[model samples]
Target: MYETEDIAVVILNWNGQDLLEIFLPSVLKYSGDAKIYVADNASTDKSVDFVRSYFPSVHVIQNSENGGYAKGYNDALQKVTEPLLCLLNSDIEVTNNWLNPIIDVFNADENTAIIQPKILDYKQKTHFEYAGAAGGFIDKYGYPYCRGRIFNAIEEDNSQYNDIKDIFWASGACLFIRNSVFKKLKGFDVSYFAHMEEIDLCWRAFNSNYTTKYVGTSTVYHIGGATLKNSSPKKTYLNFRNSLFTLVKNTDSNLFIRTIIRMLLDGIAGIRFVLQFKPQHFVAILKAHGSLYLNLGRLIKERKLLPNRSNYYNTNSIVWSYFIKKRRKF
Candidate 1:
């Protein structure tokens, strides 16, 4: 069985001293004997100093430059020797007794390499968060959705998904994985920089015949978009760009057909945004496609390196399902 000390709660920070001040206490109070780390991404503020001054017991790994999420964690986690790594976000407030269920699941299944807890919104408390509501799932066209959330629709908690289950990807907000598995996957692709890197890593694990799971019994409240707001055009750009990067790198077969369909749908969404007067978001999509084209050769090279498995996705198109069929809640 995995002990509490085996888990490292590593939070990536970047100019978020206020977030650490508010949320770090609850983590210390509830995290049992697990090692807590503040992986500061070279924040210019007093975030590093404050953690050292106040929460001295919390270890600090000072990264040279802000490598965003993917490279920040990649650099910081190299110093951690623990068996389990919990890549907790700086903006999340973890609940009491969150580690026990995760440890139980880890000891129960060796093949389960990654685990994500049920993420609720810190603001609403009763509603599921947008980033990761329950477990996460993806469609054939690389669209991601969750049990309690699909697109912008969020579901209220009613003890419906409070059970251990398999999932496609775990949210980066509070993701857990075996250290060995993480190293085997070589951590998140630094190319992602931010947004959907976890899904790419999870897809890599899935391709390598490893499992990702959702332990709903363990819970955390995430203040979604604390660093990057969901409505920001930059967020739109990264989500769109990184998603194409993920799909190209991990899809099972028919790369050309799948990518063409995905891009066509993205075009439709861009047109919709234009109709809605959200021109910036439309431009973000265009920029996203442009990035994909520039990186396509690299993605193809990377894709050839990983193992491909059939039946990795369930739904054909989450866009058609959520927008046309109006199936809001999963």
Candidate 2:
């Protein structure tokens, strides 16, 4: 029961006409007084016009070019003046009092900067979506894992993760944060474009002494990868490239070195795909590394801005825990 009508819900749309039609109606139904903004990323499919025609009350910003995920949301965020800001995907459908609990969590804690809701797959209902499940966590080497997803293992959302806990990062799919904190952090890094930009932002928040939490009370159903399915080459490229970029920008020198070693080992894991003549995996890896090399100067410049100068996790500990020892998936 936040008295102030201060939440701004920002959804980024790019060729998501079908999802917009289904998701927007439910959002407007459940979200009481939150202002809504749909940022269209230059979709040739006329998604902008469709949203305007159907949802006249929703503010629509039509971009001339596809600015990717982070940039598209950044564009919309600029217009947001509300104290609370929610960066939701256009593919999400809300049920119950989904927005209120998140607002309550932030209201309860003055230091809490960002919070995420429990996310389930819209069609499956029981299973967690690949985008985010309970909440996201980070390994010692800066690799991100979540309660419901571990290296692509999406679990059933069985209310097992109902307890609230501090998290390393919240999924960008349905994230909420204080507008002032968002502005201080300067929003999402445009260099990331998409994929892992939220994790990078969370890492910065942690460095700046702000806490992020997972509020299981609030929930939403997500149509995972409506924008970035595995079959799409461009999506594959962004995931790989941005994952690497986030690691480089956030981790200190020692952790960065360990990440490089872990990446080499991970590359070996894809050898089977290469052997099976699956060229996309190899192409994704090649393009990712190639892009990193080309953007070395930019990455270095970004790295200098991180608050901490020394690696927090010990190298030997990470190697013994994550590397060297392999556990079987039962």
Candidate 3:
């Protein structure tokens, strides 16, 4: 049984009954004594009832509306009293003793404010998942990638990254963060709604001198893109737009230069999408930029309040390195 009273595994839910039916059992079976709660985002279906009926031991926190992931967790987590908050996704399946190693890490270091478990793919099994892979890092221009994933390239889990290490960001798919730190940072930016909000939170934590880490001994399988398919135009828009917002709000230096260069790179991405006959994706990038332009003033004002860390990034240009250099495997 898990010994920690400080940790709570809170899975944010929308209309995900099928996902709960398939994945919830694994979490229940493997999570041991850690308190499990499903924070429902006003799911219209019987997801909350299903949890109540089938998994009565699992607590359910219901919100009044579907506020997406950012506000969904922000609202539900306010009710959780645990010191450590594991913000898990409903589409993830936990392995045996996954919580212990992570809990051990948290117990060891008070400075380690956030941690992400090594995430493998539920479908592929041998491959690392796209969401968080081994650990997450960002380019100098704020494009986030993982140790086992660069862009669309996902590497096989050959135990290459099987060690505890500091990471720039923790994947929200299975993020473990100190509750006090989470609240201190004001949870996630609700304006994000979803997508890249986790990165923004991690960057903020870094600015506040807290560390994010990846504990490789703890592993979970993620069935990513369940709620919003990667192919969806809306998904494309949110990702691109939220990424821009993250860059603007968190970067400590060269804000204008980096933003301009990033926009140019995004334009190149849009052109590539158009050349590939995916005009919808191109248009999605355009819409993302339009949204970013409208919200630039507020984002700039928010930057003034944040402590900008210049050494936050691990690489120069992930776009150039991934595409131009042909460096796919991480």
Give the TM-score of each candidate. Answer: 0.99, 0.91, 0.98
Q: What Cα-based lDDT does every candidate model obtain?
A: 0.95, 0.79, 0.93
Best by lDDT: 1
Residue-wise lDDT of candidate 1 within 74-105, one digit each (tens)? 99999999999999999999989999999999
- What local lDDT score does residue 262 receive in model 2, on the 0 to 100 scale? 57
Q: What TM-score should be assigned to candidate 2?
A: 0.91
Model 3 lDDT at residue 126: 99
User: Each model's number of backbone clashes?
Assistant: 0, 0, 1
Q: Candidate 3, residue 250: CA error in Å?
A: 0.9
Candidate 2 wrong stretches, greater than 4 Å: 1-4, 309-330
Candidate with the greatest TM-score versus the true structure: 1
Which regions of candidate 3 deviate over 4 angstroms? none
- The 10-residue segment of model 2 with minimum total lDDT is 311-320
Per-residue CA lDDT of candidate 2, range 1-330, in tens?
Answer: 343378988889899898898899998888888888898888988788888898898988777778888888787778778888889999999987888788888878989999999999998999877777888876656556777876666788778888788887899999998999999999888987888899888888877889899999888999888877876767767777887787777776675575677578547645745897877877887788789889978987877877753433322333234334641110
lDDT of 3: 0.93
lDDT of 2: 0.79
The true-versus-predicted C-alpha distance at residue 247 of model 1, in Å, is 0.5
